[model samples]
Target: MKRSVLLLLGILLIVLGVVSIGALKREIRISTNVTVSKSEATSFRVLSSAEQISSWMEGITLQETLVEHPENVGSRYRLTQVDGSEWEATVLDLEDNRRIVMLLTDPRAEIHIEVELFPSPEGTRVQIDTITRGSTVFYRTLMPFAKRSILKSQMRINEHWKRLIETSIESLVGEWSGTDASGSEQLFEFHFDGTADWKVSSSAGEFQLKNLLYRRNTLSQPQQLDLTGFQKGPLAGMTLFGIVDLSRQDTLIYDAAAGKPDDASARPETFSESATVYIRIR
Candidate 1:
């Protein structure tokens, strides 16, 4: 009876091993996206900066470069966590201001990540795709759980980046004084509360254009400016897509279309002869 019982226990162990092996997945993939109110160049710069990694990436205590390659391709970085765990990341591909692909590895698993940025109506769209494969059977079985955790981390990182970029918009706050095409005195007041107004003073009289809203993407070439919510005039309730040159803090080179373009490419590429030149008054 003792030998028969031992043989039955051995058979049960074999069955359990087979079941565990069958549960292992070959790989897991995760895709996450975020729309940030910054230019594509700005988003890519933040994402690729090693110095900023710890600020947005959760639990990373430190990061150091192990290998350096020109243009960032083939560069390797070592990331250390608070718990003393470490991971190595190697840049596999890079497209300046466009896309980047990385290979991340640890003892237990390996991950391939691709990040792509595109110009969006909001500012920039960031897309992150990752494929995870385990080096051991134990980790392979845990892929599903790891995928969920990684996705949450990615979303958190994106939010952190968005906040970082928004701070750059503060430079445009305050009032600017300029003149319209007819040489009428023009005043633009940009409030931190996200509301703005265009006030005009002419021999006719002083009147304010109410219900105006303004947004800026400072990192874009020629810098992007959008004005919406015009309460009166021909552009009432329409967005006027515009560009500004802020290279000089004391002056602003501002140009906007009289009306929204059917396509973004049709927007102004350079300051026109009639572009309004504004001097910072506050």
Candidate 2:
């Protein structure tokens, strides 16, 4: 049987997603939470609904291959990414606006991947936690070494969604609110036509709200994003020497410890942590 490169790649993507354990209970849980310029509820609403996941994970190519685009309990799908990596994932659990658990079962790469979306005062936080319990001692020991580096890279890849959305906002698509969940007023008439707001400063350097704008164009294509209102504040003038590519996904927030670049006078000078928000804001 002839196999297309995409088909074979899709098969391997899913295989790499799993890190097997013979008696390890078939479970591996690792998570990374990231904040975007959206809501916990809204972020969950999108990501938790596995059907919409490909919007943020555009690199995955086989999403449309799922049986029903199933996202509910026990819903399963076989997805292949742009690189031809594929995985067989089953929906293990789902909690609206809180959590979504996905299990990828492949002997070569058996593991559990759970992703959570959080709404913060600063932005929409996303957590991709994973769990991989190896069955045998030899298998378990080698699992981390074989997978952790790749796992970290996966987190950064997903982080790219935040960057993509912020770019849309900075490009001036529309208005967005980055206030954390605590401040969200149900009373306000807010609509996310996929818009965002951004600011520049000395301490944090240049940071946009993490509200990723997701939308469709008039032709109903995947043009789902908008950003606007670029402003500078007190922190805008601070000198920045560190860096974080909010535009790049998969770079986990907790893991990104480098400082950022900031300049009040548009010329490098004094800088401080105040120039950057510890979290990866848009």
**Candidate with maximal lDDT:** 1
Q: Per-residue lDDT of 1-282 in model 1, one digit per residue for the tens?
A: 999999999998876665475365657888888887765545665666655545434688889889986456787889888999888888788665578788888898888888898777787788888888887777776765676787888788778877875554334555689996878889987754357888889998888886577778877888999888876778775678899986653477788885653445545988898899988665
The C-alpha RMSD in Å for every predicted model, in order, reads 14.1, 18.0
Measured on C-alpha atoms, candidate 2 has an lDDT of: 0.46
- Candidate 1 worst ten-residue window by lDDT: 165-174
Model 2 stretches astray by more than 4 angstroms: 1-29, 52-59, 64-66, 69-71, 81-85, 133-141, 164-282
Clashes of 1: 0
How high is the CA lDDT of each candidate model?
0.74, 0.46
Reference-based TM-score of each model: 0.54, 0.43
